[model samples]
Target: MPLLAGAATVVAVVGAVLALADVDSPLRGPFTLFFLLAAPSVAIAAALRGLDPFGRLLASVAGAITVDMLVAQGMLAVHRWSVRGGIAAVTALSSVLLLLVVVRRLRGRTASRRTS
Candidate 1:
């Protein structure tokens, strides 16, 4: 989760710098940061705290889509490249991280059970 947050922060900072410099960019700082952090953060929180897996997945996907839309709008405003690529990259990476966490937890559980 911290790793995801850090990555999101970096992306947000980059986006913000680009925005301030009037460079073509897909998203604003705040929105990019929020979405980048929020999706994985929420997913990890939900999973670790006993939220349903389906629910977590749904929330993450929705969050990602919302961020993608916002980024697309930002890019459109600046007449930059389409936001699709960045959005896809972020979403894919986040999903992979989320899956990894879940898998690791599950493996730990199975291992402990076997030991017991």
Candidate 2:
């Protein structure tokens, strides 16, 4: 599990760097696509810890696609559509979602400790 996560992290970082840097590598497109899909999916899955694994996976994947579409739509609506902008927006949104989940879990833990 840890190895999988570490590898995923490496892939995501590489993707973001390649995309943001406008690198001319064959790996960039596929890696960036993976990052775009994986980032929000993982964030959503973290928030939905109560669900069974399969259900969570399904829901999170759908949610990630929805997020990507929304970002694209928003950028198009504003007439500011660009690959880098879309990627950054998605990244920012995903980070916020993950951060909120972390904060919620920390609060829950603190409350449980206080009660005990």
Candidate 3:
């Protein structure tokens, strides 16, 4: 599990770096797409711990797509659309969601320990 997570993190970072740097490598597109999909999916899936695996996967993927679309639409609406901006916004949003899940889990553990 840890290895899989490490691999995903590496892929995501590489994708973001490639996009931000304006690199023209063949890997830029596919890796960026994977980063866009995987980041939010993982963050949302982390939050939804009670659901069955298949259901969680489905929901998280759907949520990830929704997040991506919403980010694009928002940027377009503001007339500030750019690839770097979009990637940065998505990364920040995903990080926030992941942080929330981590905080919630830690709070739950501490509260349970107090009760015990």
Candidate 4:
């Protein structure tokens, strides 16, 4: 799972670079889609970390798609639909979600240590 996350992150970074550079490469479209979806998927996985493997996969995919659509609609509302905006929105939301996951995990550990 970590390997999958890492690969997705790498692809996302590459996609962001391609988008920011405004490259005319053939791979740009697919890579951009990867970038848009990858971070949210990772974040969803983090949020559902306690779930079983199959449940986690299903939840992550659904959550990622939901996040993507919300971001897209938000961009459309502001009339700023661009690759950079898409990437930024995904990255920001994912960061927040992952941060929440870390905070929750840390609090859980601290509570356990206290109880012990």
Give the Cα lDDT of each candidate.
0.63, 0.97, 0.96, 0.86
Q: What TM-scores do the predictions have? A: 0.39, 0.97, 0.95, 0.87
Which parts of model 1 have CA positions greater than 4 angstroms off? 1-33, 40-81
lDDT (10s digit) by residue, model 2, range 1-116: 99999999999989988999999999999999999999999999999999999999999999999999999999999999999998999999999999999999999999999999
Judge candidate 3 at residue 27 and give its lDDT: 93
Colliding residue pairs in candidate 2? none
Write candidate 1's Cα lDDT for 1-116 as tens digits. Answer: 99986987677556645544556555665665565556555555545555577776666667666655675676677777544455455566567767888898899999999999
Residue-wise lDDT of candidate 4 within 3-95, one digit each (tens)?
Answer: 986887787888878988999998888888887777788788988878999999888988899999999999999999987778788889999
Against the true structure, candidate 2 has what lDDT?
0.97
In terms of TM-score, how similar is model 2 to the real structure?
Answer: 0.97
Distance from true location, Cα of 72 in model 3, Å: 0.2
Order of all candidates by TM-score, from best down to worst? 2, 3, 4, 1
Clashes of each: 0, 0, 0, 0
Stretches of candidate 4 off by over 4 Å are: 1-5
Off by over 4 Å in 2: none
lDDT of 3 by residue, 28-83 (tens): 99999999999999999999999999999999999999999999999999999999
lDDT for 104 (candidate 4): 94
